[model samples]
Target chain A: METTETLNETQLITKDQLLNQWLGQRKVTRRVLDAFPEKELFEFTIGGMRTYAQLTKEMLAMDGATAKGVATGEWSTLDEEKSELTTKADLLASWDESTEKIQKYWKQISIKNFQEKVVAFGQYEGTGYSILFYVMDNEIHHRGQGYVYLRALGITPPNFWEQY
Target chain B: METTETLNETQLITKDQLLNQWLGQRKVTRRVLDAFPEKELFEFTIGGMRTYAQLTKEMLAMDGATAKGVATGEWSTLDEEKSELTTKADLLASWDESTEKIQKYWKQISIKNFQEKVVAFGQYEGTGYSILFYVMDNEIHHRGQGYVYLRALGITPPNFWEQY
Candidate 1:
């Protein structure tokens, strides 16, 4: 406790800015989601791995669900039933829904809440900030897979740096 | 500015914890980096895409370079001369160097600095926090590529969720 208290105390950035920064990642990720060719999105795979569309499903399930949990102090297991997505359009529509959910639930998180501890998705015990970073990190990790899939399919992916 | 002013301020986590979180990521990425076969590390490409080893070189260059720049208010383009790595062992060694650089430079960052904007690498401009997130996001994105490549070669990747 003394160490925590002694470490430092500063906002660094506002909560809104943090949210916007996260939203920026989501936007850029959305573009990556869009860049996939339809048939390839759901069917293409390297070796026996799942397709990029399948990877996006995991992201869609986590992004909003985890944030909403952090914001409201409620953790639900990943709802695989709800995420039974089939096509790229279905996945994109779900992505948009998750984005809306993020926007709505994000405002519920005061700056103090970011420091509060929570169990993400009913597992992964950590602070809200770490959990948020986890969500973003997971998306980025999978998005990297999407980029590989696109390249393998002879398609160019959206520029990784362009998130705006 | 008004909203920024109104938000409550806190560190949420310690510098050591944050660095560990990043190191945890690097550790996972290192496993992914190691999973690549010798030939596949440099030559395997999906439709003319850069090899996984080449992708990792980009990660090695950016990860430390960006954070070091933020810490010292100095931005230099990636030291490709240093990252002229070829073998997987070479890449992993550079990865370790970057990890050390992250630990060393991370301490130099005060809490207030995370809020200050900087032109990372003399190019991308954003707050210290955003820039840091960018560094992590980039790594995750490319690691995803490594995962695909591993799968394409019929090699199982390290579990994506496990970072410890």
Candidate 2:
């Protein structure tokens, strides 16, 4: 039902929309992290098993992994091994590193290959776009959790829609 | 500087991060939309620009454009001529349509293509991955603006780090 012109336009728009969504999440995450009192970062929990600091650590690890994937042509898999970062500063620093890697790696993607499907890992197989979307979605979910953590700590995060 | 094994692992991690990020943004956007009084949706604005409703309409249109590109494997371009949605319902409906399309289209990407380059219009010309990141980043930028608008309206947005 869609013409070629229509489809082309959609692809471009989709790319932009996804990018915007990720940036918003990043801002929110940063605000949430900053709102936390250093003392509560490690012990704060809402759903019984969630810790504010632990979640942040996971976020850093995940971002690092995604950046690595983009940098290399190969998809990474999670082993039973849990990666750890000791402090907020360390986590933030790692996040910075991952962000750089992600930017560098993204520069390598070509138009022709955006839609190819390769099995990224066990039970996780989809086209390159899907995988990328998945990565973004995962961050958002965790970030939402971070929001809750901020609230429990009696801190108001920045507005979700704020651009700056 | 990185080994192949390390790169592969990072790729996998990146995919997860991307997905998480997407989910987080969606949650925040939904909250922003929900917080708006129905009548205010069409009139809300931070600067002199169009309101959140207007921006959402633009986002939906862009989604269609992005979908077209993925379906046809061609680069999508934006039209110089702009169109606007007249009502909140119209904008909301359009947003829904775009969300569905984005999800569907993302299923078509492959891991090997994450590094392939594409001619993304605008200031930067880079890989598909870069473009994807751009889209995510762009949404966040705009969403942050939405937050400022919310604050101006005296609405308390959810804490950015909340676990919900």
Candidate 3:
């Protein structure tokens, strides 16, 4: 509400720390994706839920592009229509590409820029920090589902807390 | 990172909008909680995964306490190793309390304070904004697991995007 007149210097965190945290979560999520058995990754669903492959694609479609939009001030419409990712190896490769894109574009965003807002993907409008957080959140959300899928298939998932 | 010095006026959104967006996701997560059958909610697990009830409690432990900490500079340690909640209704009631607490404490946080950092729950040091975003992200992540549990139990989960 603007009542706090002076900026609090003690509370500030370096931009590097924030970005690293987000990237750490991404690393854990990629492991979640890899835990899935190849067949189940694309075929397993309970009660009409989408497969882990589909969910991964949904995450892939947004994260890199959203960060790019935030960094460059350009918003492009995305095609939500996705084809099946037939193999786990292929999906993992695509996930690696997205992670690289995030690292590359992340350098373009300044700490002050995180407070700025943008209409991400030509739709939802929010601060750069909020939108980027959504992408990260969305990945974690889907990864949770992947954990469930792994369990259902009688496979143990990678530890959830070992992101770093 | 500060090389692009020109101010971008169009990329801005109010704090209220950001909070509402987070609340909208929380609403859908509540619906996910509702979809679970009582017995399965607490007991169902695959490959030794935590029950959906456990995941929900983990979320509850963080959200309300987090907002309180960000609003004020103090954080109270939560007892995570507590006993069972016993009933679905009781769990949901506790969840409602946490949600209400978030709303109440959110007002205490000033916009400028979001940039300030804090060590949330005696760990995970990050900015107020990043910490709050983690709370929201953690909820979404666990909620995704709930969706999987529902599906595995032969129940149809609510639409994911219907949160907004």
Candidate 4:
């Protein structure tokens, strides 16, 4: 397979940009959650699937694990039991906690540390780089679903490209 | 604003897993696209944003525009003109083209490349990253919107996290 070389040595992103991106993602997620009716959240699905609320619960579980990984710098050592977040408030609280944890951990990352190889668990073993991609990607994948859920309920989510 | 580090290394992601993740995203997108009513696609918005069709057009415009900074590589360029995509077929075709391009580029990336900084175009400013987290995140973010749109139309997307 042909491999592309890295971009020229450039500090392309600053701490502020990263922070803004994370915050923006959280903001969108909050809006999506707020727009849905509580009853519909658990029942809405295309095809045979769990509702958005179920997905939120799953996210809450993962956030707890990811937080542990970030706090200790040990991704492979985190537990995998599903955490139950039964209410929207619980989900939001969990989201806030995870966001705080992620923010704290992001600050500790240096440009050099991104390149360092590390082991990752869940859905086949992978490196730190790939694992991090999974974390962010998973959130996005579900967020898109939230939009569909919102539209079904006649609510429009904020623009995907807009900041704040 | 704090930045945190991922504990897992980059080497853990296998090619199969990466492909699976990409495929899964496409599947979810397709489901959302299928649910849209042709009439509502162009003007639909949640929270005062453009509809999925509008978003798709924006994605299409990124291709073949050097100034738009969405061209294959070249991250320093910037273009502000928003191109219009006339039909769903055109938008879908453009989406197909972009996905192919993205896959082609992604295949060229290796474990080592994930850690290197990359200046990706098509954002507020030409920002860079060691990992392609933003790209995947961007896709997922939009995909989530598709889900909401589907819900609003009383259509359900397939179970995204389910194993076939």
The DockQ leader among the candidates is 1
In model 3, where do residues sit more than 4 Å from their true spots? A1-18, A72-85, A107-131, B1-18, B81-84, B110-130
TM-score ranking from best to worst? 1, 3, 4, 2
Residue A16 of model 1 has an lDDT of: 65
Per-prediction DockQ comes to: 0.49, 0.04, 0.35, 0.21
DockQ-based class of model 4? incorrect
Docking class of 3: acceptable
Alpha-carbon DockQ of candidate 3: 0.35
Worst 10 residues of 3 chain B by lDDT: B3-12
Against the hidden reference, what TM-scores do the models get?
0.88, 0.47, 0.77, 0.59
* Per-residue C-alpha lDDT of model 4 across residues A1-164, encoded as one tens digit per residue: 11212322122333344456657766777777777787787677754546888777656555535534533456654333334666777767877887787777766654444444545434344444344545566666777777766765678666766546
Query: Residue B47 of candidate 2: its Cα lDDT?
Result: 30
lDDT of each residue in B46-82, candidate 3, tens digit only? 6687888888888878888998999997898865544
Candidate 1's iRMSD = 4.1
The runs of at least 3 residues in candidate 4 whose Cα sits more than 4 Å from the true structure, single-residue gaps closed, are: A1-9, A14-16, A67-73, A76-83, A110-113, B1-55, B63-93, B96-138, B145-164
Error in Å for residue A36 of model 3: 2.6
Residue B7, candidate 3: alpha-carbon lDDT: 24
Where does the lowest 10-residue lDDT sum fall in candidate 4 chain B?
B1-10
Chain B TM-score of predicted candidate 2 relative to the true chain B = 0.74
Instruction: Kindly report which residue pairs in candidate 3 clash with one another.
Output: A11-B117, A117-B11
Write model 2 residue lDDT over A1-164, tens digit each, in one string.
24423333223333333444555566677776767777787776643545667766666655645534543556566542235555666556666676666666655654323445546543466556556655665565456555545654567756654534
Return the top candidate by lDDT.
Answer: 1
Residue-wise lDDT of candidate 1 within B38-76, one digit each (tens)? 888989887787788887887877888777877888888
